[model samples]
Target chain A: MIKVDNISMRFNLGIEKNFSMKQFVVDLFSPSKRKEKKKKKVNNEFWALKNVSFEVKRGEVMGFVGTNGAGKSTLLKIVAGVMKPTEGKVSVGGNICPMIELGAGFDSELTARENVFLNGAVMGYSRDFLQSKYDEIVDFAELADFMEVPVKNFSSGMIARLAFSIATIVEPEILIVDEILSVGDAAFQKKSEAKMRSMISGGTTVLYVSHSAASIKALCDRVVWIDHGHVKMIGDAKDVCNEYLRSLGLPVEGEGNGA
Target chain B: MIKRVWLNFKKYSFLLKQLVARDFKIKYKRSVLGVLWSVLYPVLMMIVMSIVFSNVFKFTTEGVSYLAYLLSGLVMFNYFSEATNLSMSSVVGNFSLLNKIYIPKYIFPLSKCLVTAINFALTLIPLYVVIIIESFSYPDMKLSLLHLVLPYDYICLFMFTLGVGLILSAVTVFVRDMLYIYGIIVLIWTYLTPIMYDITIISNPILQSLMKLNPLYLYINFARQIILHGWMPTPAYFAACGGSALIVLLIGMAVFKMNQDKFIYYV
Candidate 1:
């Protein structure tokens, strides 16, 4: 089980000085030539997530549907042990496999085969484990012919294929993916979805974040609608997605609301 | 706790092997002489010093070959200086692995120490060759007189280098300019450590007592007694250097642990 309680994050948005150049320029140059005006106050503190609480049971496929800047990535990182929560507790019962940034650890100077082993080791797999599954990893990435060539020479899609292949190869109790399915071509996307399907079928808990309502409906058993860093609704995928679409003034299933 | 260190040992063993291979390859990748370049540096330094001191000022080695004495000190001092200097930048330079992984941060510094040890081994071939040549030329030389009899000194030198490297690596994280500062310190340290001159050159009692507390001085003395005088160090001297290194290692580790958490935030 995974639980998050009362998590809030704040960021300071300004320079470390008495005045900013924009403010100074505005103060010096008035729009009108008539009279002096009062100074405007600037807000510095901005909250990204405010008192968010949630719990995910074992083997649950939880789709996090949120608008842009809704703190989805931050929350996923906190649960993945990559970042600490500022205001609350997040207790996860098992090892978390984070596919947050695919291809993030690959060194350009190293070959694809070498990078696969190194990346796997960095992801907490021993060399023996990598050795046992080496053939499968290379075969899954479909780069057998070009495995020895440097990764810097690989195209963006090829790199994505390799990263996606290595990420899905590991078996963990909880898998956290953030906006991964949006990459690669349609065929590779299908392959990634199939991989996730197997993990779901095998009873691995997953927290997938995406803005696409269709993908969430296709994969997640439950959906969470988030806006402005707070949960607006939590229920079945179809119901929550319908409510989220309606809030955006889009037509829901069986309901046509004219904009 | 031992198991955690053992796990780290297994993890870093592969990393260190890879790094050493890479270091040797990159160091000589474009050079024409390749591995021979390691020999050329000390050889060239020995020639220049011998010509300048022996010919110009009649500064003899007082029965010992000037080349052998200089080479002996050079081999050990080079190891110490290079290891400490390289470790200063090792942590920041490996920021890619440092930021992504949560392993012990000391691995970066420790790996550089291993690289230095490898290079030191390579350089010792020449050291041995020179010692044999000098012994043959002198005719009164005994095989068990120097390093062959007094192996503890060389071990002390290695320990001291590891300790100093740990401290320098930790300090270099906060002060960006410490790399350059450490370079200057190494130059001054070589002069003070009796690497080029003997410790007895200082005649004052107060200065002599101060030199006793200097860890490098003890290290060079250990080397000198083994290689030049053919005797083992006093137990007290051995204990002093070993204890000092252990203390520095502890302090260095403590400082590194305290500051390692903020590395991602800064770099």
Candidate 2:
């Protein structure tokens, strides 16, 4: 289970056209110039998330749907324990497996076999567990022959497949995925979706963020639609997603509202 | 705080081992000479320093061969230099991993320091070989069981380097110029310490004490006493080295804890 209470994130954007630490130091010595620069800077405190409160049950699939720059990724990152919110607190029970960025922890110089263990270790998996699951991970990724090849030589699709394989090797209590399902070919996509469905059936609470509304409707039990860092609507997946699409002036499914 | 750190260390010990393994593998991956470079590097430096200082500068090594004395100092100093230098960029170099995962932030620098320590251990094989050969030639120079204290000296040196490394890695995340600045500092620091020359040349007691304040000098001096002269270091010398390491380590941990959360923003 996870509980997020009034979480907010604030970022200070330096407003100077070419702000650097050197210039900041120079401005520090001259109070008069510092005041002038401060007055000129506008809306420096950008709130990426504002009073975003939500909860996830132990075995629920929650989907976060929003356009780009809507704080979906930021909220996911906060839940994954990679970032801290400026305002409120979050309590997460059980270990979380975050598939935030594919191949983010991989070493380009190491072979795929080595990276399997490397990425596994990063996710806090012990070596013995990874060794036992090594065959399954490789068979799932379908890179059996290329296990000895350096990861830098693999194609982007192959890398994504390897990352997904490593992240989902175990049945995590909570899985946080950010735009990972959109990669790779159609066949691999279908296979990964099946794998996610199996994990969901195995009592995994998944918090997923994606721009695709179709996947949200298909996979999520509850949908939270966020716009401009605020929750616009939260409820049943079908209702919330329909309302979200309606707000965007797009056609609702089965409604015959077309251009 | 200590309990929290201990629990975290226990939880992440596996990750730490893998990271150290990765660093070592990457270091010697494509090199033709491989681990031999660790041995050859200090030997080459010892030869060059011996030739220059012994012939040109006419610096005496008290009674022991200048080469043996220089090698002892070079081994410890090189370990300090390499460990600190590698760890200074450990955090910034792994910004990608930092941004994506939620492991303890100090693990990166700590692992880099450990990998360098492993390299130091490998280099010691040749160092001991050189010591044994020198003892055969110089009757006054004999290997003593007291040299067992050398491992303790290394532990002190490792701790000191790790403490400084933590501070440097954390600071470099915000100020990239720290890399260049640290390079210059290490170069000047090498000369300031008694790596190339004997400290006895400085007759002034106050100046000698000032040089002794250098942590590397203490460890290097203690090591030379045990390895080259076959004499046990005084308990005060042990306390000085260990105490300096503990103080620096505490300061480094405090600084790292304060600055770690802010690292995501800076990097």
Candidate 3:
């Protein structure tokens, strides 16, 4: 289970036209010259998240949908514990495996097999466990032949597949995936979704973010619609997804929200 | 707080090993000489300094051979500089990893220090070789059991480098200009630490006391006392070296912890 309690994040965006530390230091000593630049203030404070509160119970696949820059990624990052919330607290129970970005910790100069252990270690897996499960991960990714090849040589799709395979090798208690469902080719996507289904069946709580409403409808038990850094709506997956689509001016397929 | 760090250490030991291993592998990946560069670097530096100081400056090495004296100071100083310099970039260099996952922030700088420590160990082979060669020329030069104290000196040096590294790496994330500024600072620091000259040459008591306050100088003096002079260091010397390490480590940890949470915003 994960709980985000009244969390908010604030960022300071610098507004000066030609701001540099060198110029700032120079301006510090010369007060008369600094007066000209005083018209443009240093920064503008903006809130990326505002008092967003939510809870994900164990064994629930919850989906987060929003437009670009709606703070979907920021919320997931806060939940994953990579970024601390500015105003509130978060409590997470159990091991969390966050696949926020494909191949985030990979060393391109290293081989695929080396990265398997490297990435697995980052996920807090023991060396012996990874060693035992090494072959299984390789078989799942179907990259057995390219295990020795450097990841820099691999295609983006290949890298994505490897990242997905290593992240899901062991069924984590909590899995946080960010728009990774559309990774790799269509066939591999199907395979990855099937793997996720099995993990969900084994009682893994998942927090997933994606732009595809259809996938959210198919997988998530409930959906949280976020807009302008606020929780716009939360309800059954179909209801929330349909409402989200309607807001986007996209046609609502088949039946309405009554269904 | 200590317990949390310890638990994270236990959990991420494998990841730390992988990171250190990756650093070592990447350093010599396409090079033909491979690990030999570790030894050759100090040897070349020793030869260059020996020629300049022994012949041109006519600097007295006291009773020790100039080559041995220079090599000893060069290796330790080089290790300190290399470790801290590499670690200064550790956080900024691993932005991708920091962005996607949450691991203890210290691990990046710590891994950089460990990799340099391994290379420093390799450089010791050439240092010892210089000592043995000098032993044949100077009858008073003999390897003693006191040389074992060199490892203690290395431990102190490691702690000091790691402490400074932690502070610099954390600062570098916010101030990108730190990279260029650190380069100039290291150059000046090398001259300040008396790496190529004997501290005894400075007859001023005030200057000598100030030199004693330098942590690197304390570590170098401890090593020289054991290896060059074949004598045990005074207890006061140990206190200076170890105390500086401890104090700097505490300060570094405090600074790093305060700034780490805001790192994502700046980076």
Single-chain TM-score of chain A, each candidate: 0.86, 0.92, 0.89
lDDT of 2 by residue, B99-209 (tens): 888889899989999999999998898788888899987765687678777889999999999999999998888778899999999999998899889998989999998
lDDT of 3 by residue, B92-125 (tens): 9888788889888899999999999999999999
lDDT by residue (A1-259, candidate 3, tens digit) is: 8998999988766533344778879999999878866643433567888889889999999999999999999999999889999999999998898988877789999999999999998888999999999999999999999999999999999999999999888878899988777788999999998888788768899998989988888889989888988999988999999999999998787765564
Model 3 DockQ, alpha carbons vs. true complex: 0.66
TM-scores of the candidates are 0.80, 0.96, 0.95
State the lDDT of candidate 2 residue by residue for A1-259, as single tens digits. Answer: 8999999998766532434778878987999988887775655778889999999999999999988999898898889888899899999999998888877779889999999988898888888999999999999999999999999999999999999999989888999988787667999999998898888778899998877888889889999998999988899999999999888888889797565
The number of residue pairs in model 1 that clash at the backbone is 2
Per-residue CA lDDT of model 1 for A1-259, tens digit only, reads 9999888765544423223456567656776521332221145556677888889999999999888888887678667765555688889998777888887557677788878876776566667777888889888888899899888899999999998888888899999888787567888888877887898779999998988888888889998777887878889989999888888887776666454
User: For this target, which candidate reaches the highest DockQ against the unseen true structure?
Assistant: 3
Instruction: Give candidate 3 misplaced runs (Cα > 4 Å).
Output: A15-19, A22-43, A256-259
**What does DockQ give for each predicted structure?**
0.17, 0.58, 0.66
lDDT of each: 0.74, 0.88, 0.88
What fraction of the native interface does candidate 1 get right in terms of contacts?
A: 0.00
Q: Which ten residues in a row have the lowest lDDT in candidate 2 chain B?
A: B136-145
